[model samples]
Target: MMMFRPIFASLFGATLFVATVLPAIAQETLPSWSDGAAKTRILDFVKATTTEGGEGFVAPQDRIAVFDNDGTLWPEQPYYVQLGFILDRVKTLAPQHPEWKTKEPFKSILAGDLKGIARGGEKGIVDLVMSTHAGMTSDQFAKIVTDWFATAKHPKTGKPFDEMGYLPMRELLDYLRDNGFKTYIVSGGGVEFMRPITEKAYGIPPEQVVGSTILTEYAIVGDVPVLRRLPKIDFVDDGPGKPSGINKFIGRKPIFVAGNSDGDAEMLRWVTAAKGPGFAMIVHHTDAEREYAYDRESAFGKLDRALNEAERRNWLVVDMKADWKTIYASEH
Candidate 1:
């Protein structure tokens, strides 16, 4: 009986030991991020939130993190994927319309004159989207996106559109999840377009994504109720609209937010303004050889205002040329 008592106590002790150490071991085995101040701050923030007795400790459910998609999660040049989708749509639909052959933006797109298409500016891009994406049911639009992402390839890299995502950002997303953060993507791109592919690319489910949306309505298509996507813009999740969308959709201020341009300034401001600990990071594209580099003068993802604000606020500005060990995962 005495020997049996000792054996039971040892087994109980071993069980306790495993219970205490298993989680730590699991955390330690997470992918190693680069050794830099940005990585250090990220790890420290996670530890503070997840570890008991830490001042920044937040319950797992409240550990919300938001990211901007285009230039943040993935590459946005030679152009945004949504733009490519629209261009393809223009090409496909041009035969039906015929007038597009003479239309300014559509004409440039059809002629493979990207510079001319961009010359139409943001308004040009918006016109292209409205022309191609509007007048379709939401289900029909979703099918278009699903089909395009399946076959679309980057012009320069010749990789699937899905493969153009930044490798380091993907690792950051996983790291946050490992630490119990629920990540959301808030982007200026069309919500429907992003929702179709984000889950596969970012590990963020569709429900957690926020972006520009068009008005939708319920309709009965042949006795089956269906939600139809309308072209009337409901919201544009860019700049200040990013913060507005976050509040409307998430209902809670994020503890972590990351973006890459002036379009993200308001979102970072909103997140950093939270009562307690928070992190705001900006991904600065500076590696021209590995990836395109543009900031103040670039037509998209311009960083001037946000860059200054980040510097003034001591927020992390990820130098693509310096901080990242690798750019796109495919490059590695």
Candidate 2:
């Protein structure tokens, strides 16, 4: 019976090893991802690009990464967060713009009639955006957005819009940054609108964000200089416009690009077309239980052409349901 003592001690040590050592071994950069092809491909790409003297080694200065904001980073369904802000702004400033009370798009927005707003299509949506996003000084616009996010919540999730960012993507961003890649947000959403929230949400600073913008003019108000957002369309950073925005803003073709829809197709095309090793990935929203999942025929973040193109080009297609173990950054 005394001979059994050492064996029992060995069994206790093995249990301790299983509890502690196995977990540490499993610790990975993307904790929200299930260890599978999607995660493996991403990690492999990062490793290849980052390894010193490796065939795919990208110089630190040239390690540019561009990401889409709306559906790519956070949730975009049920209208974009920016559009939500505009609808709320229509309500906030309706008392001031009394004519907007009965205005076509503005009236629809104010009444919380999204179906009505959708019927107006591109022209009506543009009208709503211009009215709400323009007229204020750039500083004032920032302040308005900053304040709106304080109280706004996603109608479906009931979580703050800022907290809706995906854990896997956030990990991807940090992981890339850690590997010396400079990340930038290139979205169809308004640049001014995203700059205020991105740093806190994605660790991307305001200067690195590029998006649609209305022209601004220098003015003096009460002896203080200000840049007032004019009521003119400067650029629309969507569809084909994404690549143009990338060239005009980042000035270098990105080595890495991640987007979720057809809107990002051109950007991915341009980035991958560059004459060297590059990676283009699309985040396919597939989790309806954790987040809204719409693609192909969806009005926003339509994934049809992009999905086919990604498959043809052999780009990474991250199926959110299968690839990710957790969706939100706050989730374990």
- After superposition on all C-alphas, the RMSD of every candidate to the true structure, in Å, is 6.5, 3.7
Model-by-model lDDT, in order?
A: 0.86, 0.90
Q: Candidate 2 vs. truth: CA RMSD?
A: 3.7
- The sequence of per-residue lDDT tens digits that candidate 2 reaches over residues 249-331 is 98998999999999999999888888988899999988888887889989878899999999899999998999989988666
> How many pairs of residues in model 1 come into backbone collision?
1
The candidate scoring highest on TM-score is 2
Clashing pairs in 2: none
For candidate 1, the 10 contiguous residues with the lowest summed lDDT are 25-34
TM-score of each: 0.89, 0.92
What lDDT is reached at residue 92 by model 1? 92
* Ten residues in sequence with the least summed lDDT for candidate 2: 22-31
